[model samples]
Target: MTKLETAFAPVAPAVDLDAYFARIGYDGPREPTLAVLRAIHQKHPDAIPFENIDVLLGRPISLDPAAIDAKLIGAGRGGYCYEQNGLLKRVLAALGFQVEGRMARVLWMAPAGAPPRPRSHMVLAVRVPGDDAAWLADVGFGGCVLTAPLALFSDDVQATPNGDFRILPIDELGGERQVQADLSGRWSPTYQVASGAWADVDYEQANFYTYAHPSSHFTFSLTAGRTTPTARYALKNNRLTHRDATGALVDQRDLSAAELEAVLRDVIGLPVEPDWRPLLEKIVAWGSAA
Candidate 1:
């Protein structure tokens, strides 16, 4: 099968279910229904952090399932969007969620007057059993990702444990929906998404550009993210930010080497790979990241 056809092609739920469930510390039902979806969604970010350490180090990321599993699940490391969502796609399909791989154009960090960012982001269009409406589930986006799947409605307010998220229809192109996020109360253009049945090759190309190109922020900055029931925590470079229930900044500070290391290990649950220990120190060390 071509990569596009295999991107999220539902064949059989034969993925290692027991291992995935164990990884997420989820003891919930796996009945291929929306309830299971919600249970899995809520537990994922709590267990797996969103990070891009390998990319920043110029390690060639392979989208191969085995590589993703080994790095993220086996190595106790975290990954950025593609790795996170790619792993989720397999797990959701293995559970019979009828999920498809999708792409989005990011605008969250676009420079003013700069063209819309590339369709570098990955999203999932899921068909929940017994529901007429499809839902958008993304466990990848770092800054303000969906902690729970949102019903794919343009104006409906969806509540998540971390914050309120609502999608607004911006423009439609060739039957695809253009949506933006209403994070807290601010409006920011998100990405234009489609059923996006292209190829794993397409995703790999985008992932390559982000990590290989100098202009891409992921190539240079250090970032990590995790969401809890009460708040969201994000660490970019050496600056750490914590937002409360209302998406208000509860804490923001430049973390010292000790402090940043603690947050990465304890809060984000990512252990330093022995080879990257020195790099990690220099990246988060006082005054060096600046």
Candidate 2:
């Protein structure tokens, strides 16, 4: 087997369930019910955060369960989608929930008339024991992240802790769906999710591109986001922004080098490495020019 395949080999939950629960500060029911999923969906991002620091640091993103557990759970660091959702997949599976991986073409900030982007974003389709219908769960969408799973079979608007969301079918057969969120009275297309089976190799390939491709935004930018019950915090380069639960901007500011480090460590709750000082300086300088 290839390295990626081996790293992703199916095994009993490699992540310690207790460690994961503690990492997210979740003490709710362990059952694979919608309530438990919702509780975790909200708590995961709030505690673990979403970040691309490893990509910016030129580190290969690993899908090995041990590595994910060590970095995100044990080491007090955050990661982008693959790590975030991949870990969630294992945890949910360990909890006896049926989980499937899915990919999406991100349209969150795509300019008008831009060519269709690749399917680079990762999400989950989950099935509870008693429910026949599936739900969409994703905790790695950065600033506008979802705090609850959206029903896969419904086109109706679903309410989450972050904001209201709707899953719109793109075709008559429902082979594809568009994920939209209500943003300040406007329903914006966040991404188009494809109804297809996804494998570990697919995630590894997409992760490789995200961390290594020059065109990938994760490789060039510094981004960290955390969603709390009251507000959502986003840090891009050196700009720190806060938006209330209603998607209204609360405040935004450019940070200096010291302030940038402080925000990453304190506000975002990332273990900002001392070795990242130089890179943090560059981020601050770029933010000033932008």
Best by lDDT: 2
lDDT of 2 by residue, 1-290 (tens): 99999997766456698999999999889999989999999999999999998888789999888999999999999999999999999999889898889999999988899999999999999999987899999999999899999998699999998889999989758589999999889999999999876876679888889899999989888889998899999999999999999889999999999999998998899998899999999888878787
Global CA lDDT of candidate 2, please? 0.91
* lDDT of the structure predicted as candidate 1: 0.77
Please state the error at residue 213 of candidate 1 in Å. 1.9
lDDT of 1 by residue, 1-290 (tens): 89999996645324577877888899988888988998888888878889888886779878888888888788877787788888888898877777777888877756779976767888888887666687888888886767788877557767777776667655554546655555557756666676456455578888888789898888778878888777789988878889875677889888776777788888878986666666667777633636
For model 1, the superposed segments whose C-alpha errors exceed 4 Å read 1-14, 130-132, 176-184, 285-290
**Residue pairs whose backbone atoms clash in candidate 1:** 4-198, 4-199
**Candidate 2 segments whose C-alpha is farther than 4 A from its true place:** 1-12
**lDDT agreement with native, every candidate:** 0.77, 0.91
